[model samples]
Target: MRCLTIAGLLFLCYVTQGVKHFRLGRGKGGNLGAPGGYSGEKLPPAQWFKQRLDHSSPSDLRTWKQRYFVNDSFYDFNKQGPVFLMIGGEGPADPRWMVKGAWIDYAKKFNALCINLEHRYYGESHPTEDISVKNLQYLSSYQALADLANFITAMNNKYKLQRSVRWIAFGGSYPGSLAAWLRLKYPHLVYAAVSSSGPLLAKVNFMEYYEVVVDALREKTGGEDCVTELKSAHNQITAMMQTHPHIVEKEFRVCKPFEGASENDIKNFYNSIADDFADLVQYNEDNRISADVKYKNLTINTVCNMLTSPGSEPAYKKLAAFNSIILEKSNQTCLDYSYDNMIKELRNMSWGSEGARQWMYQTCTEFGFYQTSSGEIEVFGNQFNLDFFIQQCEDVFGKKYNADFVQASAEWTNSNYGALDIATTRVVFVHGSVDPWHALGITKTQDNDAPAIYIKGTAHCANMYPRSENDSSDLIEARVEIEQYLAGWLGLP
Candidate 1:
């Protein structure tokens, strides 16, 4: 026993020593470029261009605030292989939070630099003044693409990358929309892109998506319970609103579920509420729950903090603030189910028009709080409770509101900026069937000349097909598509 114990101690010491030695050796290699080759040459200058880093850069020391014109924000970086520039959505630009965990691991696998550049007015990338409707107009997609272009030029000069370095601009959700736009705007700057669950087609149907959510929930939960409960809650809430109009109209006018919510509002309500749950289920089937479950309410605390902040105690100031904003912007509603235009589109089952209308309503509302004029918000008040929900949207947008200014924004969206057309660049779009935002991802009705990957049961962005558990046949096929496409671009083995 004593001998065995001694041997055990020796083995433990041996393993510990090996680990320490390995770490020390890693340290001596001077940390840039792919791992595993120790040629004993003196480390290259800090600016030396390496395809991948020998080891990941220290996350703590890596974050530094960089200025681009009026905007200032901290940037996190992985100083390795071909740099992957990740443009985030409309929210704060902490790449760590936005891309979830997939990016960190992906950096290691590809031996590429991972850079998270925060969008202007988001996180540390704030402009000199608070955001409001008047100034919010500047946050247009065109302006953002310019910012990205500038940032890339700055980084290239600072690092003195060997020649024109290959970069991959990628993102999902709002950022995904931005990614597609950026690729079109600056193809030379971006070698390749992967826009997951991105909504490029701005003219999408917001209300029908509520229906999709309902169908998805019913399909996943295996019951009318969720549908029944949600519908009941919705009807009860709507009827309660009619009775206590003040409570809804003045105090808590939240963004109504897609479609001004019909007598079948209950059914519509359940679908909207269940959509996210269905997304989770489609991605993770092991934890499926009842149809009657309000998953958002359950994960509200966790999810809300990530998406928006719940203010104060007692009655919850955040909720109250949300109500106030919604009431103020209630005028700019969309063509609800009752509207002749909407009815016509529905009767024809016009997918494109419905999608465009929904996207317009939802995006405008979410973006409405930042509009510069009252007219814009008022125009779509019935369909979108812009004023009522502006505060809530503000919580997520991380900017101050300027109702008058933002109200003027309706025109730009209405006019349609620089015609949306086919791109000369190699744009790769991906989407999940279950996502409410899927309508926006549709570049064209039929597959266009550009490459696209739509995972059958997937949800948002890097979520549907998890990098960790993508052993299924469909996932494998998708992976092959990605690998082949990227390989062709990268000339990889």
Candidate 2:
């Protein structure tokens, strides 16, 4: 059910063609009834199809094997006035799941049906598999997009939609990637989309992005001392590895179940320490007085917590396997065996890991240190060729992969979504300056056939917040343009 609005009351009778049409205020004895036209006249099947999209076959999900539970209430575009198929970002979050308090109030002003479809292998819709590195190959971005497009067509057929509907796609991070893809793939289906904090660029470079953070620290933090400490730690970690590869291996391999660092897993030690220091700074940016104390407390507490939380058994094993194959044996890794094919496989694995939803491709590559043949555990892609890193992931995780899907995705990334002609769609890309995934924003890249705006210091989807000066001015402009474009199209004021 939606809150009543002025726009809602006025669009009660307007009908679009080649799609299902919904008329407002139509209920029992109110000139409209269930399974009938909004006017309550004996509607023809043709008219019925005009009002709904049909998706009843199980084979619709043949490739994925998950059942599509159709909600009849969901099929009602008439009651809702118009349908706005809303797809969520990746993670365990279902597309049907709505964060009531999180959505923008202004965005909700549009009276439309919102359908949130979950990805194939997350939450209750999980596929029956070992759910380890073994079966992750099935969860590529392309496959996920296919699932969504198929559903949309099915719904259109099921409902007998009266007119070609307009989709305004919006998502942050991974789902943001999907949104950008959808707009590119189905230009006719989507009038516009808002991609927030999503990097359409694949074959990511971790060192490059982390360098941003490192540089940001160096520039903002007043200290050659802190820089010295950082550089010293790096040198120490690197030096410690040559003679102590096994020790480094043992430390990072075991997921700390408890709190403090029991062993000298240099990588784990640093990650734990970093998280604490970041938490302190993020939570209390205004409390500048005890910042140093907070940092010290975080270091002590994080180190202590590592001992308690050593990490899950399976996670440690998987991590260990990665270290063993890719880092410890880089020569035998995908690097030597089949370099070209390996890169394609790497990107696919990014989304198919243990908890696919939480995996941020860019951030993971940037932060998760991988072992190199030099006995160094470095971040995602240290060098320029991202495909090399992607291949490393596949080499590390022996999951079944789709050669076609990988190749296709690689090509798509190379062209920068040029296949979609992003310029053709009335697309609006939004991003936050401080967002970890901000690198995913479409700046310095082709607009995918549309316009883009970046917000400063905002996190993913933070642009939805009401006006605040600290908010992205560009984001504000993009929204205004989006509103204007929609208004012009719908003939609304």
Best by lDDT: 1
Supply every candidate's count of residue pairs whose N, Cα or C atoms clash at under 3 angstroms.
56, 62
Q: For every model shown, what is its TM-score relative to the native structure?
A: 0.53, 0.54
Using TM-score, give the best candidate's number: 2
Query: lDDT by residue for model 1 over 1-493, one digit each (tens)?
Result: 0000000001111111011100100111110111111234333111111111111232422222332221112222333246667673343332222222333334444655556565543333434243443434444565567667767776777756655457777665556656667777787787777665664543312333344445555544555544454444344445555565444333333333333545333332222223333233222221111122333233222322322333333222333343232222222132122222322332221222212222222344433311111222221112232343343233323344334433444345434433234453556677655554565456343434367776655444433223444234554566567656655666555
Minimal lDDT window, size 10, model 2: 1-10
1-493 per-residue lDDT for model 2 (tens digits): 0000100111121211110111010100111001101223221111111111112344443333432322233334664334454453333332222322112332355554455554555433454344444454444555556666777776767667656565566555556666778877777666666665555655333233444333333333433433344444445445555565454436433232223322222333343323222222221111111212323233212322332234453322332333333222112221111222222333343334323212323122222221121211232112223343344344444332223334444555547555323444565666655443455347543543466666543443444333444334565665576566555554456
Error of 2 at 475 (Å): 6.1
Score each candidate by Cα lDDT. 0.39, 0.38
